[model samples]
Target: MPRTTLAPTLALMLALASPAAATQEYILPTLFDVAGVAADDVLNIRADPNPTAPVIGTLAPDATRIEVVEERRGWVRVNTGEGSGWVNSRFLTYRTDVWNEGALPQGWQCFGTEPFWAFIPQGDSVVLGGPDTPNDMRKVQSVLSTGVFRDPTRAVVAEGMTLVSTPQLCSDGMSDRLFGLRAELVIQGNQPRMLSGCCSIQP
Candidate 1:
Protein backbone atom coordinates (compact mmCIF):
# COMPACT_ATOMS: atom_id res chain seq x y z
CA MET A 1 0.00 0.00 0.00
CA PRO A 2 1.26 3.49 -0.89
CA ARG A 3 1.49 6.11 1.90
CA THR A 4 -0.73 9.16 1.38
CA THR A 5 -1.87 12.19 3.35
CA LEU A 6 -4.38 15.05 2.97
CA ALA A 7 -4.12 18.71 3.98
CA PRO A 8 -5.56 19.60 7.42
CA THR A 9 -8.18 21.93 5.87
CA LEU A 10 -9.43 19.29 3.46
CA ALA A 11 -9.41 16.69 6.24
CA LEU A 12 -11.67 18.90 8.39
CA MET A 13 -14.08 19.44 5.50
CA LEU A 14 -14.29 15.72 4.83
CA ALA A 15 -14.83 15.05 8.54
CA LEU A 16 -17.73 17.50 8.63
CA ALA A 17 -19.24 15.89 5.56
CA SER A 18 -19.35 12.62 7.46
CA PRO A 19 -22.65 11.89 9.27
CA ALA A 20 -20.87 11.34 12.60
CA ALA A 21 -19.47 14.84 12.58
CA ALA A 22 -23.01 16.18 12.51
CA THR A 23 -23.81 14.36 15.72
CA GLN A 24 -23.47 16.20 19.04
CA GLU A 25 -20.19 14.96 20.51
CA TYR A 26 -18.74 17.76 22.62
CA ILE A 27 -18.51 17.64 26.45
CA LEU A 28 -20.19 20.21 28.67
CA PRO A 29 -19.07 22.33 31.60
CA THR A 30 -20.59 21.54 35.00
CA LEU A 31 -21.56 25.10 35.71
CA PHE A 32 -23.52 27.45 33.44
CA ASP A 33 -23.10 31.25 33.20
CA VAL A 34 -26.78 32.03 32.70
CA ALA A 35 -26.68 35.38 34.49
CA GLY A 36 -23.26 36.40 33.15
CA VAL A 37 -23.08 38.30 29.88
CA ALA A 38 -20.74 39.71 27.23
CA ALA A 39 -18.77 42.77 28.20
CA ASP A 40 -17.50 44.27 24.93
CA ASP A 41 -17.93 42.23 21.75
CA VAL A 42 -21.20 40.75 20.58
CA LEU A 43 -22.02 37.24 21.80
CA ASN A 44 -23.07 34.85 19.09
CA ILE A 45 -25.85 32.33 19.79
CA ARG A 46 -25.84 29.25 17.64
CA ALA A 47 -28.26 26.51 16.75
CA ASP A 48 -26.01 23.99 18.50
CA PRO A 49 -23.66 24.01 21.49
CA ASN A 50 -20.64 24.37 19.28
CA PRO A 51 -18.81 27.31 17.74
CA THR A 52 -19.05 25.77 14.26
CA ALA A 53 -22.82 25.66 14.64
CA PRO A 54 -24.72 28.28 12.64
CA VAL A 55 -24.98 31.62 14.39
CA ILE A 56 -28.60 32.36 15.14
CA GLY A 57 -28.17 35.71 16.89
CA THR A 58 -25.78 38.09 18.63
CA LEU A 59 -25.82 39.88 22.01
CA ALA A 60 -24.80 43.49 22.46
CA PRO A 61 -21.43 44.23 24.00
CA ASP A 62 -23.18 45.12 27.25
CA ALA A 63 -26.16 42.83 26.87
CA THR A 64 -27.61 41.14 29.96
CA ARG A 65 -30.26 38.64 31.15
CA ILE A 66 -28.66 36.01 28.94
CA GLU A 67 -29.63 32.52 30.12
CA VAL A 68 -27.65 29.34 29.47
CA VAL A 69 -29.91 26.30 29.28
CA GLU A 70 -27.44 23.74 27.96
CA GLU A 71 -23.74 23.11 27.64
CA ARG A 72 -21.35 21.16 25.41
CA ARG A 73 -17.62 21.46 25.95
CA GLY A 74 -17.26 25.13 26.89
CA TRP A 75 -20.27 26.23 24.81
CA VAL A 76 -23.56 27.13 26.49
CA ARG A 77 -27.14 27.39 25.32
CA VAL A 78 -28.64 30.85 25.64
CA ASN A 79 -31.91 32.70 25.12
CA THR A 80 -31.32 35.98 23.27
CA GLY A 81 -34.97 37.17 23.61
CA GLU A 82 -35.22 36.49 19.88
CA GLY A 83 -34.95 32.75 20.53
CA SER A 84 -33.06 30.04 22.41
CA GLY A 85 -29.68 28.98 21.08
CA TRP A 86 -26.10 28.16 22.05
CA VAL A 87 -23.03 30.35 22.58
CA ASN A 88 -19.49 30.00 23.81
CA SER A 89 -19.57 29.85 27.62
CA ARG A 90 -16.34 31.81 27.97
CA PHE A 91 -18.04 34.75 26.27
CA LEU A 92 -20.24 35.16 29.34
CA THR A 93 -19.06 36.56 32.67
CA TYR A 94 -20.26 35.86 36.20
CA ARG A 95 -23.73 37.24 36.65
CA THR A 96 -24.12 39.85 39.40
CA ASP A 97 -26.67 37.63 41.08
CA VAL A 98 -23.79 35.41 42.13
CA TRP A 99 -23.05 37.92 44.91
CA ASN A 100 -23.84 36.31 48.21
CA GLU A 101 -26.06 38.64 50.20
CA GLY A 102 -24.79 37.20 53.46
CA ALA A 103 -21.21 37.73 52.34
CA LEU A 104 -21.76 41.46 51.79
CA PRO A 105 -20.51 43.89 54.40
CA GLN A 106 -23.15 45.98 56.10
CA GLY A 107 -20.51 48.68 55.97
CA TRP A 108 -16.85 48.74 55.10
CA GLN A 109 -14.09 51.26 55.54
CA CYS A 110 -11.68 50.39 52.77
CA PHE A 111 -8.05 51.44 53.05
CA GLY A 112 -6.23 52.31 49.89
CA THR A 113 -3.00 54.20 49.29
CA GLU A 114 -4.21 57.75 49.85
CA PRO A 115 -7.90 58.61 49.76
CA PHE A 116 -10.04 55.92 51.38
CA TRP A 117 -13.51 54.59 50.51
CA ALA A 118 -16.41 53.58 52.66
CA PHE A 119 -19.28 51.30 51.72
CA ILE A 120 -22.49 51.63 53.65
CA PRO A 121 -25.43 49.42 52.84
CA GLN A 122 -28.96 50.35 53.80
CA GLY A 123 -31.85 48.14 52.77
CA ASP A 124 -31.30 47.33 49.13
CA SER A 125 -29.27 50.47 48.49
CA VAL A 126 -25.57 51.26 49.01
CA VAL A 127 -23.43 54.35 49.40
CA LEU A 128 -19.87 54.90 48.22
CA GLY A 129 -18.26 57.66 50.23
CA GLY A 130 -14.81 59.13 50.24
CA PRO A 131 -12.99 62.45 50.63
CA ASP A 132 -12.05 62.38 46.95
CA THR A 133 -15.49 61.26 45.92
CA PRO A 134 -16.59 63.45 43.00
CA ASN A 135 -19.87 64.30 44.69
CA ASP A 136 -20.94 64.00 48.33
CA MET A 137 -21.17 60.35 47.41
CA ARG A 138 -22.67 57.95 44.88
CA LYS A 139 -25.76 55.92 45.72
CA VAL A 140 -26.43 52.61 43.98
CA GLN A 141 -28.90 49.80 44.40
CA SER A 142 -28.22 46.09 44.37
CA VAL A 143 -29.39 44.66 41.08
CA LEU A 144 -29.15 41.22 39.52
CA SER A 145 -26.31 41.32 36.96
CA THR A 146 -23.18 43.42 36.67
CA GLY A 147 -21.18 43.89 33.47
CA VAL A 148 -17.88 42.93 35.08
CA PHE A 149 -15.48 41.31 32.61
CA ARG A 150 -14.47 38.20 34.62
CA ASP A 151 -15.87 38.65 38.10
CA PRO A 152 -18.20 35.72 38.75
CA THR A 153 -19.01 36.86 42.24
CA ARG A 154 -21.28 39.56 43.72
CA ALA A 155 -22.55 42.46 41.63
CA VAL A 156 -24.93 45.42 41.82
CA VAL A 157 -26.70 47.17 38.96
CA ALA A 158 -28.95 50.17 38.30
CA GLU A 159 -30.53 51.60 35.15
CA GLY A 160 -27.25 52.01 33.27
CA MET A 161 -24.87 51.05 36.06
CA THR A 162 -23.32 47.98 37.68
CA LEU A 163 -21.13 47.66 40.79
CA VAL A 164 -18.83 44.82 41.78
CA SER A 165 -17.17 44.03 45.13
CA THR A 166 -14.43 41.54 45.75
CA PRO A 167 -14.94 38.75 48.25
CA GLN A 168 -14.01 39.30 51.94
CA LEU A 169 -10.41 38.14 51.69
CA CYS A 170 -8.28 35.08 51.24
CA SER A 171 -6.07 35.76 54.31
CA ASP A 172 -6.95 36.78 57.82
CA GLY A 173 -6.07 40.23 59.20
CA MET A 174 -3.78 42.63 57.29
CA SER A 175 -0.85 41.25 55.36
CA ASP A 176 0.98 42.30 52.24
CA ARG A 177 0.04 38.96 50.73
CA LEU A 178 -3.65 39.54 51.48
CA PHE A 179 -5.36 41.72 48.93
CA GLY A 180 -8.73 43.09 50.02
CA LEU A 181 -11.84 44.29 48.29
CA ARG A 182 -11.67 46.79 45.47
CA ALA A 183 -15.07 48.00 44.39
CA GLU A 184 -15.61 48.45 40.67
CA LEU A 185 -18.25 50.53 38.98
CA VAL A 186 -19.52 50.05 35.44
CA ILE A 187 -21.91 52.43 33.82
CA GLN A 188 -23.19 52.78 30.33
CA GLY A 189 -21.93 55.76 28.32
CA ASN A 190 -19.02 56.15 30.72
CA GLN A 191 -15.64 54.69 31.55
CA PRO A 192 -15.25 51.98 34.17
CA ARG A 193 -14.23 53.25 37.59
CA MET A 194 -12.42 51.60 40.47
CA LEU A 195 -12.44 52.29 44.21
CA SER A 196 -9.31 50.43 45.20
CA GLY A 197 -9.17 49.70 48.93
CA CYS A 198 -8.83 47.00 51.54
CA CYS A 199 -11.88 46.79 53.76
CA SER A 200 -13.19 45.06 56.84
CA ILE A 201 -16.83 44.11 57.16
CA GLN A 202 -18.66 46.67 59.26
CA PRO A 203 -18.67 45.56 62.90
Candidate 2:
Protein backbone atom coordinates (compact mmCIF):
# COMPACT_ATOMS: atom_id res chain seq x y z
CA MET A 1 0.00 0.00 0.00
CA PRO A 2 2.55 2.56 -1.07
CA ARG A 3 2.58 5.24 -3.77
CA THR A 4 5.70 6.54 -5.49
CA THR A 5 6.30 9.81 -7.28
CA LEU A 6 9.11 10.71 -9.67
CA ALA A 7 11.38 13.55 -8.61
CA PRO A 8 10.86 16.85 -10.45
CA THR A 9 14.25 16.66 -12.23
CA LEU A 10 13.70 13.04 -13.25
CA ALA A 11 10.22 13.84 -14.47
CA LEU A 12 11.53 16.70 -16.54
CA MET A 13 14.19 14.50 -18.07
CA LEU A 14 11.58 11.87 -18.87
CA ALA A 15 9.38 14.41 -20.50
CA LEU A 16 12.16 15.67 -22.69
CA ALA A 17 13.00 12.13 -23.69
CA SER A 18 9.43 11.33 -24.63
CA PRO A 19 8.36 10.86 -28.22
CA ALA A 20 6.56 14.18 -28.25
CA ALA A 21 9.68 16.08 -27.24
CA ALA A 22 11.71 14.28 -29.84
CA THR A 23 9.41 15.25 -32.67
CA GLN A 24 11.08 16.56 -35.80
CA GLU A 25 11.21 20.26 -36.36
CA TYR A 26 9.88 21.39 -39.73
CA ILE A 27 13.15 22.15 -41.43
CA LEU A 28 13.55 24.28 -44.53
CA PRO A 29 13.78 22.83 -48.03
CA THR A 30 10.94 20.58 -46.95
CA LEU A 31 7.84 19.69 -48.91
CA PHE A 32 4.40 21.21 -48.56
CA ASP A 33 1.02 21.00 -50.26
CA VAL A 34 -1.43 23.67 -51.19
CA ALA A 35 -4.23 23.77 -48.65
CA GLY A 36 -7.20 25.91 -47.56
CA VAL A 37 -7.58 27.39 -51.03
CA ALA A 38 -10.70 27.16 -53.14
CA ALA A 39 -10.51 24.59 -55.91
CA ASP A 40 -11.42 27.32 -58.40
CA ASP A 41 -8.75 29.62 -57.05
CA VAL A 42 -5.00 29.48 -56.83
CA LEU A 43 -2.61 30.19 -53.96
CA ASN A 44 -0.67 33.30 -54.80
CA ILE A 45 3.08 33.37 -54.51
CA ARG A 46 4.00 36.91 -53.63
CA ALA A 47 7.21 38.76 -54.28
CA ASP A 48 7.27 39.50 -50.57
CA PRO A 49 5.76 37.94 -47.48
CA ASN A 50 3.11 40.63 -47.11
CA PRO A 51 -0.38 39.95 -48.37
CA THR A 52 -0.27 42.99 -50.63
CA ALA A 53 3.06 42.04 -52.08
CA PRO A 54 3.17 41.55 -55.81
CA VAL A 55 1.65 38.27 -56.91
CA ILE A 56 4.40 36.70 -58.90
CA GLY A 57 2.99 33.23 -59.30
CA THR A 58 0.24 30.86 -58.21
CA LEU A 59 -0.17 27.25 -57.19
CA ALA A 60 -3.17 25.11 -57.96
CA PRO A 61 -5.43 24.04 -55.15
CA ASP A 62 -4.38 20.45 -55.70
CA ALA A 63 -0.67 21.19 -55.90
CA THR A 64 1.36 18.85 -53.73
CA ARG A 65 4.98 18.15 -52.85
CA ILE A 66 5.91 21.81 -53.18
CA GLU A 67 9.42 22.58 -51.98
CA VAL A 68 9.50 25.40 -49.46
CA VAL A 69 13.04 26.65 -48.92
CA GLU A 70 12.57 29.22 -46.22
CA GLU A 71 10.06 30.52 -43.70
CA ARG A 72 9.57 33.82 -41.96
CA ARG A 73 6.72 35.13 -39.86
CA GLY A 74 3.59 33.54 -41.38
CA TRP A 75 4.97 33.13 -44.85
CA VAL A 76 7.08 30.54 -46.65
CA ARG A 77 9.54 31.04 -49.51
CA VAL A 78 9.55 28.95 -52.64
CA ASN A 79 11.37 29.02 -55.95
CA THR A 80 9.49 30.66 -58.79
CA GLY A 81 11.42 30.14 -61.99
CA GLU A 82 14.39 32.52 -62.19
CA GLY A 83 13.63 33.88 -58.76
CA SER A 84 11.84 33.04 -55.52
CA GLY A 85 8.60 34.24 -53.98
CA TRP A 86 6.74 34.12 -50.72
CA VAL A 87 3.44 32.41 -50.01
CA ASN A 88 1.21 32.56 -47.00
CA SER A 89 1.98 29.65 -44.74
CA ARG A 90 -1.67 29.52 -43.73
CA PHE A 91 -2.52 28.20 -47.15
CA LEU A 92 0.14 25.54 -47.05
CA THR A 93 0.41 22.25 -45.21
CA TYR A 94 3.69 20.63 -44.34
CA ARG A 95 4.11 17.17 -45.79
CA THR A 96 4.77 14.40 -43.27
CA ASP A 97 5.40 11.45 -45.54
CA VAL A 98 8.66 12.15 -47.28
CA TRP A 99 12.42 11.45 -47.35
CA ASN A 100 13.47 9.08 -44.62
CA GLU A 101 16.71 7.40 -43.61
CA GLY A 102 19.07 7.76 -46.55
CA ALA A 103 16.60 6.78 -49.19
CA LEU A 104 15.62 9.25 -51.88
CA PRO A 105 12.11 10.60 -51.55
CA GLN A 106 9.62 9.30 -54.06
CA GLY A 107 9.50 11.36 -57.25
CA TRP A 108 12.98 12.67 -56.48
CA GLN A 109 14.61 14.14 -59.56
CA CYS A 110 17.54 16.44 -60.25
CA PHE A 111 18.41 18.45 -63.31
CA GLY A 112 20.60 21.27 -64.50
CA THR A 113 20.96 23.55 -67.52
CA GLU A 114 23.66 24.55 -70.03
CA PRO A 115 24.51 20.88 -70.37
CA PHE A 116 20.94 19.91 -69.49
CA TRP A 117 20.76 16.58 -67.70
CA ALA A 118 18.41 14.66 -65.44
CA PHE A 119 19.02 12.24 -62.60
CA ILE A 120 16.15 10.06 -61.47
CA PRO A 121 16.22 7.37 -58.83
CA GLN A 122 14.11 4.32 -59.53
CA GLY A 123 14.02 1.67 -56.84
CA ASP A 124 17.45 0.03 -56.84
CA SER A 125 18.84 1.86 -59.86
CA VAL A 126 19.13 5.35 -61.30
CA VAL A 127 18.26 6.80 -64.68
CA LEU A 128 20.66 9.39 -66.04
CA GLY A 129 19.77 11.34 -69.11
CA GLY A 130 20.44 14.55 -70.90
CA PRO A 131 19.90 16.43 -74.13
CA ASP A 132 23.28 15.36 -75.44
CA THR A 133 23.54 11.95 -73.76
CA PRO A 134 21.27 8.97 -74.03
CA ASN A 135 19.44 7.74 -70.96
CA ASP A 136 21.47 5.19 -69.08
CA MET A 137 20.47 2.93 -66.21
CA ARG A 138 22.98 2.52 -63.40
CA LYS A 139 22.79 0.40 -60.27
CA VAL A 140 22.58 2.28 -57.03
CA GLN A 141 25.63 1.65 -54.94
CA SER A 142 24.43 3.34 -51.76
CA VAL A 143 22.52 6.16 -50.18
CA LEU A 144 24.26 8.10 -47.47
CA SER A 145 23.22 10.86 -45.15
CA THR A 146 24.05 12.58 -41.88
CA GLY A 147 21.70 10.08 -40.19
CA VAL A 148 19.46 12.77 -38.79
CA PHE A 149 16.04 12.62 -40.41
CA ARG A 150 15.47 16.35 -40.15
CA ASP A 151 18.84 17.04 -41.76
CA PRO A 152 18.16 17.51 -45.46
CA THR A 153 21.49 16.58 -47.01
CA ARG A 154 22.09 13.26 -48.73
CA ALA A 155 24.16 11.47 -51.31
CA VAL A 156 23.29 8.77 -53.79
CA VAL A 157 26.02 6.64 -55.31
CA ALA A 158 25.39 4.80 -58.53
CA GLU A 159 27.34 2.63 -60.90
CA GLY A 160 29.23 5.38 -62.63
CA MET A 161 28.12 8.50 -60.85
CA THR A 162 27.57 10.09 -57.47
CA LEU A 163 25.02 12.76 -56.66
CA VAL A 164 25.04 14.87 -53.54
CA SER A 165 22.27 17.27 -52.68
CA THR A 166 21.87 19.75 -49.91
CA PRO A 167 18.86 21.60 -48.59
CA GLN A 168 19.24 24.90 -50.35
CA LEU A 169 17.48 27.12 -52.82
CA CYS A 170 18.17 26.06 -56.38
CA SER A 171 16.93 27.41 -59.67
CA ASP A 172 16.64 25.37 -62.83
CA GLY A 173 17.61 28.46 -64.85
CA MET A 174 14.69 28.08 -67.26
CA SER A 175 11.59 27.39 -65.19
CA ASP A 176 9.13 29.19 -62.99
CA ARG A 177 9.40 26.36 -60.54
CA LEU A 178 11.82 26.65 -57.59
CA PHE A 179 13.66 23.71 -56.14
CA GLY A 180 14.68 22.80 -52.59
CA LEU A 181 18.01 21.14 -53.19
CA ARG A 182 21.19 22.04 -54.97
CA ALA A 183 22.71 19.01 -56.60
CA GLU A 184 26.25 18.21 -57.69
CA LEU A 185 26.77 15.16 -59.83
CA VAL A 186 29.96 13.44 -60.91
CA ILE A 187 30.11 10.85 -63.61
CA GLN A 188 33.09 8.49 -63.88
CA GLY A 189 34.67 7.30 -67.08
CA ASN A 190 37.90 7.78 -68.98
CA GLN A 191 37.04 11.43 -68.78
CA PRO A 192 35.18 12.18 -65.58
CA ARG A 193 32.63 14.93 -65.81
CA MET A 194 30.92 17.05 -63.15
CA LEU A 195 27.60 18.83 -63.33
CA SER A 196 25.59 21.05 -61.03
CA GLY A 197 21.87 21.67 -60.91
CA CYS A 198 18.73 21.88 -58.83
CA CYS A 199 16.53 19.11 -57.43
CA SER A 200 12.86 18.73 -56.62
CA ILE A 201 10.80 16.16 -54.82
CA GLN A 202 7.70 16.99 -56.80
CA PRO A 203 6.58 14.79 -59.62
Candidate 3:
Protein backbone atom coordinates (compact mmCIF):
# COMPACT_ATOMS: atom_id res chain seq x y z
CA MET A 1 0.00 0.00 0.00
CA PRO A 2 1.21 3.53 -0.72
CA ARG A 3 1.91 5.74 2.27
CA THR A 4 -1.42 7.11 3.44
CA THR A 5 0.21 10.39 4.51
CA LEU A 6 3.32 11.89 3.04
CA ALA A 7 6.07 13.35 5.18
CA PRO A 8 6.52 17.14 5.33
CA THR A 9 9.74 17.78 3.39
CA LEU A 10 10.89 19.40 0.14
CA ALA A 11 11.84 15.98 -1.29
CA LEU A 12 8.49 14.63 -0.13
CA MET A 13 6.67 17.35 -2.10
CA LEU A 14 8.51 16.36 -5.28
CA ALA A 15 7.84 12.71 -4.59
CA LEU A 16 4.16 13.45 -4.03
CA ALA A 17 3.93 15.49 -7.21
CA SER A 18 5.23 12.62 -9.35
CA PRO A 19 2.70 10.30 -11.08
CA ALA A 20 4.13 7.41 -9.02
CA ALA A 21 2.53 9.07 -5.98
CA ALA A 22 -0.75 7.62 -7.29
CA THR A 23 -0.70 3.94 -8.09
CA GLN A 24 -3.11 1.94 -10.23
CA GLU A 25 -4.14 -1.45 -8.89
CA TYR A 26 -3.11 -4.45 -10.96
CA ILE A 27 -5.27 -7.41 -11.97
CA LEU A 28 -3.71 -10.86 -11.63
CA PRO A 29 -6.29 -13.10 -13.30
CA THR A 30 -6.48 -16.66 -12.09
CA LEU A 31 -8.68 -19.72 -12.51
CA PHE A 32 -11.84 -18.89 -10.57
CA ASP A 33 -13.35 -21.63 -8.41
CA VAL A 34 -17.07 -22.22 -7.72
CA ALA A 35 -17.17 -24.89 -5.06
CA GLY A 36 -17.73 -25.33 -1.33
CA VAL A 37 -21.47 -25.97 -1.61
CA ALA A 38 -23.72 -28.66 -0.24
CA ALA A 39 -25.28 -31.04 -2.75
CA ASP A 40 -28.48 -29.02 -2.65
CA ASP A 41 -26.43 -25.85 -2.85
CA VAL A 42 -24.84 -26.66 -6.18
CA LEU A 43 -25.03 -23.85 -8.75
CA ASN A 44 -28.01 -24.36 -11.03
CA ILE A 45 -27.06 -23.85 -14.66
CA ARG A 46 -30.25 -22.13 -15.70
CA ALA A 47 -31.63 -21.75 -19.22
CA ASP A 48 -31.50 -18.01 -18.78
CA PRO A 49 -30.09 -15.38 -16.40
CA ASN A 50 -33.21 -14.93 -14.27
CA PRO A 51 -34.01 -17.12 -11.31
CA THR A 52 -37.26 -18.05 -13.01
CA ALA A 53 -35.29 -19.51 -15.88
CA PRO A 54 -35.57 -23.27 -16.19
CA VAL A 55 -32.80 -25.33 -14.66
CA ILE A 56 -30.83 -27.07 -17.38
CA GLY A 57 -28.28 -28.75 -15.15
CA THR A 58 -26.22 -28.24 -12.03
CA LEU A 59 -22.59 -27.26 -12.30
CA ALA A 60 -20.49 -30.40 -12.67
CA PRO A 61 -18.21 -31.32 -9.82
CA ASP A 62 -14.50 -30.49 -10.34
CA ALA A 63 -15.33 -28.75 -13.58
CA THR A 64 -12.41 -26.79 -15.04
CA ARG A 65 -11.58 -24.99 -18.29
CA ILE A 66 -14.96 -23.30 -18.22
CA GLU A 67 -15.55 -20.69 -20.89
CA VAL A 68 -17.35 -17.38 -20.42
CA VAL A 69 -19.90 -17.06 -23.20
CA GLU A 70 -21.46 -13.71 -22.38
CA GLU A 71 -22.76 -11.45 -19.63
CA ARG A 72 -26.13 -9.66 -19.39
CA ARG A 73 -28.23 -8.20 -16.60
CA GLY A 74 -25.62 -9.39 -14.08
CA TRP A 75 -25.84 -12.97 -15.35
CA VAL A 76 -23.07 -14.80 -17.11
CA ARG A 77 -23.67 -17.36 -19.85
CA VAL A 78 -21.12 -20.12 -19.44
CA ASN A 79 -20.51 -23.26 -21.45
CA THR A 80 -20.08 -25.67 -18.57
CA GLY A 81 -19.53 -29.19 -19.84
CA GLU A 82 -22.80 -30.34 -18.30
CA GLY A 83 -24.66 -27.63 -20.24
CA SER A 84 -24.65 -24.07 -21.46
CA GLY A 85 -26.69 -21.67 -19.38
CA TRP A 86 -26.83 -18.44 -17.41
CA VAL A 87 -25.63 -18.21 -13.82
CA ASN A 88 -25.46 -15.22 -11.50
CA SER A 89 -22.23 -13.64 -12.64
CA ARG A 90 -21.51 -12.35 -9.16
CA PHE A 91 -21.61 -15.92 -7.82
CA LEU A 92 -18.84 -16.84 -10.22
CA THR A 93 -15.35 -15.58 -9.42
CA TYR A 94 -11.92 -15.89 -11.01
CA ARG A 95 -10.01 -17.30 -8.03
CA THR A 96 -9.39 -21.00 -7.36
CA ASP A 97 -9.67 -20.93 -3.57
CA VAL A 98 -12.10 -23.50 -2.17
CA TRP A 99 -14.81 -22.27 0.15
CA ASN A 100 -17.26 -25.15 0.65
CA GLU A 101 -19.45 -23.09 2.92
CA GLY A 102 -23.02 -22.08 2.16
CA ALA A 103 -22.94 -18.63 0.56
CA LEU A 104 -19.89 -16.39 0.53
CA PRO A 105 -19.79 -12.64 1.12
CA GLN A 106 -21.58 -10.84 -1.74
CA GLY A 107 -19.04 -8.17 -2.76
CA TRP A 108 -18.39 -4.69 -1.41
CA GLN A 109 -19.92 -1.43 -0.23
CA CYS A 110 -16.94 0.60 -1.35
CA PHE A 111 -16.39 4.28 -2.07
CA GLY A 112 -13.72 6.36 -3.81
CA THR A 113 -12.70 10.01 -3.40
CA GLU A 114 -12.57 12.21 -6.51
CA PRO A 115 -15.22 10.60 -8.68
CA PHE A 116 -16.94 9.09 -5.65
CA TRP A 117 -18.49 5.65 -6.29
CA ALA A 118 -20.39 3.38 -3.94
CA PHE A 119 -20.80 -0.39 -4.37
CA ILE A 120 -23.36 -2.17 -2.23
CA PRO A 121 -23.13 -5.93 -2.34
CA GLN A 122 -26.63 -7.36 -1.94
CA GLY A 123 -26.65 -11.16 -2.05
CA ASP A 124 -25.74 -12.09 -5.61
CA SER A 125 -25.76 -8.61 -7.10
CA VAL A 126 -24.41 -5.15 -6.30
CA VAL A 127 -26.01 -1.70 -6.23
CA LEU A 128 -23.62 0.92 -7.61
CA GLY A 129 -23.91 4.71 -7.46
CA GLY A 130 -21.24 7.30 -8.16
CA PRO A 131 -20.48 10.68 -9.65
CA ASP A 132 -20.55 9.57 -13.29
CA THR A 133 -23.87 7.82 -12.89
CA PRO A 134 -26.69 9.89 -14.38
CA ASN A 135 -29.74 8.26 -12.77
CA ASP A 136 -30.94 5.46 -10.55
CA MET A 137 -31.13 3.02 -13.42
CA ARG A 138 -27.55 3.75 -14.36
CA LYS A 139 -26.45 2.78 -10.84
CA VAL A 140 -27.22 -0.87 -11.46
CA GLN A 141 -24.25 -3.13 -10.59
CA SER A 142 -23.09 -5.01 -13.65
CA VAL A 143 -19.30 -4.93 -13.36
CA LEU A 144 -17.55 -7.25 -15.78
CA SER A 145 -16.40 -10.58 -14.28
CA THR A 146 -12.62 -10.67 -14.37
CA GLY A 147 -12.06 -13.19 -11.56
CA VAL A 148 -12.44 -13.95 -7.85
CA PHE A 149 -10.31 -12.55 -5.00
CA ARG A 150 -7.35 -14.46 -3.62
CA ASP A 151 -3.88 -13.80 -2.11
CA PRO A 152 -3.27 -12.89 1.53
CA THR A 153 -3.36 -9.07 1.27
CA ARG A 154 -6.07 -9.15 -1.45
CA ALA A 155 -3.38 -8.23 -3.96
CA VAL A 156 -5.21 -10.61 -6.32
CA VAL A 157 -7.13 -9.35 -9.31
CA ALA A 158 -10.77 -8.44 -8.90
CA GLU A 159 -10.68 -6.99 -12.34
CA GLY A 160 -14.05 -8.58 -11.53
CA MET A 161 -14.88 -7.71 -7.84
CA THR A 162 -14.24 -8.90 -4.28
CA LEU A 163 -15.51 -9.30 -0.74
CA VAL A 164 -13.71 -6.96 1.69
CA SER A 165 -15.36 -6.75 5.12
CA THR A 166 -17.70 -8.83 7.21
CA PRO A 167 -21.22 -8.52 5.80
CA GLN A 168 -22.65 -7.46 9.14
CA LEU A 169 -20.62 -4.25 9.16
CA CYS A 170 -21.23 -3.32 5.51
CA SER A 171 -24.13 -0.92 5.61
CA ASP A 172 -23.91 2.73 4.54
CA GLY A 173 -22.12 5.24 6.83
CA MET A 174 -20.56 2.41 8.83
CA SER A 175 -16.90 3.06 8.20
CA ASP A 176 -16.40 2.74 11.91
CA ARG A 177 -17.23 -0.97 11.55
CA LEU A 178 -15.03 -1.84 8.55
CA PHE A 179 -11.94 -3.87 9.49
CA GLY A 180 -8.80 -5.45 7.96
CA LEU A 181 -9.18 -3.85 4.54
CA ARG A 182 -6.41 -3.54 1.94
CA ALA A 183 -7.31 -0.43 -0.06
CA GLU A 184 -7.59 -1.63 -3.68
CA LEU A 185 -10.17 -2.61 -6.30
CA VAL A 186 -9.96 -4.04 -9.81
CA ILE A 187 -13.23 -2.51 -11.04
CA GLN A 188 -12.80 -3.68 -14.61
CA GLY A 189 -10.34 -5.03 -17.16
CA ASN A 190 -8.42 -1.76 -17.42
CA GLN A 191 -10.01 0.47 -14.80
CA PRO A 192 -8.17 -0.69 -11.72
CA ARG A 193 -9.28 2.09 -9.42
CA MET A 194 -7.99 2.84 -5.94
CA LEU A 195 -10.22 2.75 -2.88
CA SER A 196 -10.43 6.33 -1.62
CA GLY A 197 -12.49 5.96 1.51
CA CYS A 198 -14.32 3.37 3.62
CA CYS A 199 -15.18 -0.04 2.11
CA SER A 200 -16.91 -3.24 3.23
CA ILE A 201 -18.19 -6.59 1.97
CA GLN A 202 -21.54 -8.39 2.38
CA PRO A 203 -22.30 -12.06 2.76
Q: Report how far off residue 174 is in candidate 3 (Å).
A: 53
- Error (Å) of candidate 1 at residue 67 is 34
lDDT of 3 by residue, 47-140 (tens): 8789998987776545543334345788766544434577675556654332212332234345655566665545445555677885222223
Please, what are the lDDT tens digits per residue for candidate 1 over residues 95-139?
Answer: 433223333423333345444555555555555556777422344
lDDT score of residue 23 within candidate 3: 38
Best by lDDT: 2
Return the TM-score for each candidate structure. 0.32, 0.84, 0.30
Model 2 accuracy (lDDT, Cα):
0.86
Best by TM-score: 2
| Candidate numbers sorted by TM-score from highest down | 2, 1, 3
Candidate 2, RMSD to the unseen true structure: 3.4
Q: Least lDDT summed over 10 consecutive residues: which range in candidate 2?
A: 1-10
How much lDDT does each candidate structure score?
0.49, 0.86, 0.45
lDDT winner between candidates 1 and 2: 2
Candidate 1 regions off by >4 Å?
Answer: 1-105, 108-111, 134-139, 143-152, 158-161, 168-182, 187-192
Ranking by lDDT: 2, 1, 3
Once superposed on the true structure, which residue ranges of model 2 sit more than 4 Å away at CA? 1-6, 38-41, 80-83, 175-177
